[model samples]
Target: MNNSVFRRLLLPGVIVLAGCSGSTDPETAHLFDNVKNLNNGEYDRQIASKDAEAAAIVRQNNAASARISTLRNQSASNSAEIKALTSQISSLRAQTSSLRGKFSNQPDKLAQLNQLDGQLVQIRADVGAGTSPSVARAELNRVSAAIRALSR
Candidate 1:
């Protein structure tokens, strides 16, 4: 009879210990799964943010390159215009010199011619030194007006 009782007690104790083993409860397992999902979602968001930032940077770089190209084109056009204007000014200077020679005997006209020549020389220097197109053009107009007056 004692052996029978001992056997009965040992069997129930073994069953209770087996139930208490390291197996996770359903609630605990669900919590762990939820934590893992949260971490993955956060990681995915970070990756998306980085991708968006990279795209923005690419766009900005492209825009900057386009602006630089436009500026280069404008500079080329301005340079060409400056060259043409310089040639026109040289022609005007030659004409002025010819007129000055014709008026050499008249002191008053000679003085006026000298003043116009000086102005032309200054304008040519400014243009050659890369002054703005508008400024150079305006100076050329003034010189042209002076030459017309001298002719009259």
Candidate 2:
């Protein structure tokens, strides 16, 4: 398709070059043709090199576009996994919290209580998507300190 369009456009250019062909006086015709051929050959070489460079650029761009598409798909998968894990943590937190008051009834109550995990999960949800896991660690530290103070 591109080749046909280029050839169609090239016809007018060929016509323009031919229009400049030949001198009315016989003496200069040979000189004119020689000079024209030299110039035309040089122009053709330049156009060929330019076309090769353009093709290289197109290939690089196409490869880059494909890479961008792959990265986008990976990002989507990572995002989905993060969401699923977040939901799972949330459900786990809900379950553990439901057992909060029941800890007093258990014989080994202190060993069974996992308040820090519930607090970390709640912190992650509050900070929202894209937050680093470190944020949850900070919440764990806070919860641990609070729990320690209460024990004393």
What is the TM-score of candidate 1? 0.69
Checking candidate 2 for backbone clashes, the offending pairs are none
Q: What is each predicted model's overall lDDT from 0 to 1?
A: 0.80, 0.63
Task: Return the TM-score for each candidate structure.
Answer: 0.69, 0.52
Candidate 1 residues lying further than 4 Å off, grouped into runs, are: 1-39
What is the C-alpha RMSD, rounded to one decimal, of candidate 1?
A: 10.4
The digit string of per-residue lDDT tens for model 1 on 1-152 reads 99999999999986666554432332443444445545567546756788999999999999999999999999899889988888888888888888977898889988888888888888878987888889888888887888888888
